[model samples]
Target: MAGNVQGESQFDVIVVGSGAGAMTSALVAADNGLSVLVVEKSDKYGGTSSISGGGIWIPNNHHFAAKGGKDSYDKALQYLKAATGGVVPETRLRAYLDNAPKMIRHLEAKSRVRYAVAEKYPDYYQHLAGSLPGGRTLDPELFDTSVLGDELPHLRQGAPSNLLMGRIAWTARQAHKAMSREFGWRFMVLGLMLRFKLDFKWRRKSKFDRRAALGTALIASLRRSLQDRKVPLWLKTEFRELVVDGGRVCGVRVVREGREVEIRARRGVIFGSGGFEQNQTLRERYLPQPTQAGWSATPPGNNMGAALEAGIAAGAATALLDKAWWAPTIRVPKEEKPRGVFAERAFPGAIVVNGRGKRFVNEAAPYLEFVEAMYKDQQASGAKSIPAWVVFDASFRFNYAMGPLMPAQIMPDSRLRKEWLGTVYWKAPTLAELAAQIGVDPLGLEETARKMNEYARTGVDSEFMRGGNVFDRYYGDTNVKPNPCLAPVQKGPFYAMRLDAGDIGTKGGLLTNEHAQVVREDGLPIPGLYAVGNCSAAVMGLGYPGAGATLGPAMTFGYVAANHIAAAA
Candidate 1:
């Protein structure tokens, strides 16, 4: 271990973590000609953002204008007000909406980060006021990983199960056809294979790198920008505490390379280190009961509330401690990380049921809404809904991907012999047999299947109205007629997988005002302290308005914080 280093490093700005929020802050600050240092606790950069779908929900962005879509501030505000039930202040929401477009314009104009509108993706609640079929979500464009050079190896990677064969990255548009085994995707797969072959050769000399998309692409683009700007990043450095002078935060004490190091931030210390989702004690104390840290989708060794704790010790106020960005996740036996299945439940010929084998939700609802339904069922029936089972038939499996099981892929016979098949996945010749194998009531499953078949034929789900909304059908199999989201479970063998209530990250953290400055319990800004992203209380409050709700405010406030620091300078 090295000896203590006191005041050996100094910068105008210090950013903790390497997620979108932290990266955005570092980039913007550096662009303003400020010396910035980024410290990441993990071995690699990119926190939960890297593993995410990488969609940023920006209302009235330039892409909307280019696509001839009209969106107004008042209209966007109206939608946010209704969605969040006015829990988030109008000033804060306005800050997010107003700064969001500016952030996009700045990043595109000055940095390597590029974005394109997801033309087919709809708002989570399309039926609500001020919602559009598309144009609100901006997905990061595909990035060439070779651009990162030596920095490529230091970036966190997306889950192997999320990618194609652990190398190829597919866009949302291509995924539908690819997972369904459509022949059109063959050419796309071939192109990816050739690219990976070349990438593998390059990897032998350096590290694994290829064309990356989704969250990985977003982070890579930002990292490329950082490298271009020559900003310094310190990995394996943990923030220990804040250094306060005259009751104002001015620097931070950190453990760097197994030694204590004191770094001074001449301007301010921006806390974008993410949330406490990976901290089991914090999760149990703040989140709803039964929601454990093991169920979080965030990478291991995340924020763990270090920033929040430091802020609290400095007299900061906290909010929304009980909320999170919820989703449904399943852990396969062989897979190291749990996978979040967003589209599987919404696809045709599938239903999510409690232990009693009864459908409790509109399986076609958004992931957050689906998890809310799971919690409601759990509250009503105890542990019955803790591990909800997603049941499907042969036609569904052949036409759609479930968890890590791609369409048309065969499970080995040895899996069944070792009972691994029934552990994470269950398959049987009949509904009764599947229920018996999974330990659910056979009669209830039989009746449920009978009603589902009737609904499929009639093109209506009378129980939960599964296919009633545009958002529901957005992920549905459009090739299927009448009701694209409905199909009978008549074909066997059927399949079932247990899903638990999981979250992308915790939403609760240090509270900040509209300017992205950390606020004290007395409603005053902490002079030299700032917070953004999951490290701060979510600007959306407890409600998720769309697909990129989490990243929207994260990037916007990161922009807000950096600009504020620049103005102070």
Candidate 2:
């Protein structure tokens, strides 16, 4: 089960991929008195889940009661219907709303998996029929990895862009508190830094921090639970194709250690192998024009759509193959992954403009909507809008960080990395000079800045309504007057950074039914086959309802798939 084994092996359930959903499927199946095995394509077990922000958007999770919050299924469905724009079936959306909370509670009661309410996090579409400002998204607690023992090395390290100073880690609540510079954040940072610096035992092994936070915490917790359940997880095992017999998927043909191995699944084969964001061929084939594989913020080498392709070969239908979980990202030099440009755009004293030096969108919009606007603007205008510029003055440089660049007080020009200062990101003493530096029109930029100053004084964004929504104001600076997202950008020494239409991952893959069964084009379920996570057509369609929309439905469906399979004879 560890390696090629070079022969036939059998398990009650064969779960593909090692992310949150896959692990849940395996662990849950084992809980139901079935043997389970997990196969992962990458050497690391976590896939992209280890590097993600780790927010699970469960509509009515157990944590809500204790937090004095409540939600109804009908309200959740109404909001989803509006947000999803009716593209997804109502039954599928209803299934997710019904099962997500149950899944979270089941895992918490039976396994090491636990989540706390991210109290202040808001839903992406607050203006919809039913949207809560907080209490829906749950964040994983930090985990001590001493329990992982020898398996520690196999756990994936997070991208530098996801961590503080390219090394330190923080939980979602901690990150939000730190971003706002709220009280006790300094103490929290000091505690983590001291723990990291003082851990001589961990330092002897590797430079990585022993405490896993955010996505790493979630994955490590799941892995520990799987270990306790005696679920075998095979690394470097690639799903070559499905093995169907008697018109049912009975097993799979996989390549492990560069050799073919056929394994039989007595009950079912569940796919949680993520999406095709890392597959360039698929990106060019299905995605919008000007798309490139390098721009996706997903893990560098994983999710090449091999699993999705195998599912398609097995006659699983597909939908939304061209859509992605879009996010505005920046190409940070020396970093392996693109850093998502979240929160930074929502801060005051910042404006995102096309190459013509005109504001194109509300910088404080949801990340997915921000990128969608970028793509739309780029298509409407030419290449000028594809690589838009985020312009800000020295006040912004001193107050907030942009991409890889730290705040001015922490990382001044003298102490900054030479490769990034003037070439990768731009800086100048005046708007026209900054415009010249970034190839933006001087007059247009000057005029835009003047209007921005006027808007800052008036506290109104007539064009895009930057801070009009509660979602935008959640990340906005409360200290700012009138509008939390607006500020004058007339200070000297303006800075600019180029943005790319990046994403957390591709949102489309094998289409599935309400029970998480992979279905054919004829809307018939494929017995003994299920798909979850980014490898399945999302339940919310093109809409991102909340912070953890991706992981929420994924785990819920994985739970759904396991139950569906376990109920079989």
Candidate with best lDDT: 2
Candidate 1: segments with Cα more than 4 A from true spot: 1-7, 176-209, 409-419
Candidate 1 lDDT by residue in tens digits, 345-440? 878899888878888899988887888889889898764887888999888877677887767544433424364486778889998889888778
> What is the TM-score of each predicted model, taking all chains together?
0.95, 0.96
lDDT to native, each model? 0.84, 0.87
Model 2: colliding residue pairs: none
Candidate 2 local Cα displacement, residue 181, angstroms: 2.6
Q: Please identify model 2 stretches exceeding 4 Å from their true place.
A: 1-6, 195-200, 203-206
Please, what are the lDDT tens digits per residue for candidate 2 over residues 93-128? 989988999999999999998789987899998889
- Evaluated against the true structure, the overall lDDT of model 2 is 0.87
